[model samples]
Target: MKMFMLKSLCLAAIMLIAVLTGMQLASSGIQKMKGYEDPNLETAVSFHEKDNNVKASILGNDISSHNIAAKKKKLEEISAFNFFSSMGKKLSNGITSASEKLIQFIAD
Candidate 1:
C-alpha cells in the first residue's frame, strides 16, 4: 500500500511538472511569434469587434423574429430527411443483431 501510494504521488508530481513546462513553452512560443508578426498586416479590428459589427448589422436590419422563424421553418421543411439519426438507428440495429448472434454462438 505504501509503495502504491508513493508511485501514485510521484506520477502526480511528474504530470504537474510536465503540464507547467508545456504551458511555459506555449506562452513563450506565442510571444516569439507575436514579435515576428507585422503590425501593418494585423487587422484594424479584432475578431470580437468584427463579430459584434456583424451582429449589430443583422439586428439593425428591418428583420422580424417571426420572419426569421418562418425562414428557419422553411429550411427545415426543405431538408426533412435527417441522415445522422437514420444512420445512428441503422448502426444500433446492426450492433444489437451482432451481439445477439455472438450470444447465441457462445451458448451453443
Candidate 2:
C-alpha cells in the first residue's frame, strides 16, 4: 500500500510538470506567430481646442485649425519562458544544494 501511494504521488507530480511544460511551449509559439506586443506600454493622447468670443456668439464663429503629430512608444519584448518553469528550476537547484550540504555535514 505504501509503495502504491508513493507511485501515485510521483505519477501525479510528473503529469503536472508535463502539462505546465506543454502550456508554456504553446503560449510561446502563439506569441511568436502573432508578433504579440505589450499593450500596457502603449501611449495615447487626448486634446481639446476651443476659441470663444461674445461677438462671435451673436454673429457666427469661423475657426480653422491644422495639426500634425506623431508619437512612438517603446515596448518590452515578452520572454519565452513561464514563471512556473523558472521557479521550479530555482527550487530544484536549492533543494539539490541543500541536500549536498547535508551529506557533506554528515560525512564530516
- How many backbone clashes does every candidate have? 0, 0
Question: Model 1: residues >4 Å from true position, as ranges?
Answer: 36-108
lDDT of 1 by residue, 1-108 (tens): 999999999999999868756765665576677887544442222223354443212212433457789999999889878899999999999999999999999999
lDDT of 2: 0.58
TM-score for all models, in order of appearance: 0.33, 0.34
Cα lDDT for residue 6, candidate 1: 100
Clashing pairs in 1: none
Candidate 2: give the clashing pairs: none
* TM-score, model 2 to reference: 0.34
- Best prediction by TM-score: 2
Candidate 2 lDDT, 26-57, residue by residue in tens: 65576677687554422122123456521211
What CA root-mean-square deviation does each model show from the true structure?
13.0, 24.0
